[model samples]
Target: MTRHGEDIGRWLATQRRDWDRLNEEQQARLGKLGVKKAARARKAPAKAATASRQGKGGEAFQKGLEALTQYLARESRMPGRAAVQEMPDGDIRRVGVWLANQKQRRDRLHPDQLAALAHLGADWAR
Candidate 1:
């Protein structure tokens, strides 16, 4: 006998467009086979808009991320929270707080933090 499992996989691919039109019994059968309906496609412009917003800080963010990554690599540890807290510049302190809160040592800086660090300049990197 043919394997119903393999047949269901093939059927799902071909029937994707007609998914909503399938009768309750057919839908239940697919459900039992662990087949899920595909998520609705997002409009391209929506993605582009978000990218533009992120792009506002992308370059600066990249610079800060590179600096932080290099610092962590060479130092094997980050500066104490107090060092950042005591920084004369508010922007630098914010960047320090952001770095302190990261769960992993290798995590990249946030876009906003990168922008702030960029404003703080090459000194922040060191």
Candidate 2:
């Protein structure tokens, strides 16, 4: 919804998000408009959350590497950007897309991750 060139939905979302920062008069005005403050979301501790995410990401990367290894063994070459392959374990992976994404984000990868891919003859991974 729009009102006088302002996006009402987006404005309401922003108002709710910044509810705590609103002065009493502002809050009253919004309250009259039936725009309530948004509920605060609970979050895990940063260290634990980061560690958990890292663990999951590492596991996923290992799975992708395994899929890539099997693909290399069969095709004797890297998969193209649009190629998809079935792993020995029967998982269908878009290995080519995965590789492309990895190559694009190589700068963000850990040294060990880059080394692993480089070892697999992925020159771009180096």
Best by lDDT: 2
Which TM-score value belongs to model 2? 0.56
Work out candidate 1's RMSD over C-alphas: 14.5
lDDT of each: 0.50, 0.83
Candidate 1 local lDDT, residue 75: 53
Q: Please give, for residues 4-97, the per-residue lDDT of candidate 2 as tens digits.
A: 9999889888799779989999999989989899985443353345345657777878888988998899999999988888976788999999
* lDDT of candidate 1 over 1-126, digit per residue (tens): 238546855666746646787888887887887876666555456445534655645554454455455545555555454433222233353334445444232114444443544444423432
Model 1 lDDT vs. the true structure?
0.50
Report per-prediction Cα RMSD to one decimal.
Answer: 14.5, 11.1
Candidate 1 residue pairs that clash = none
Error of 1 at 37 (Å): 25
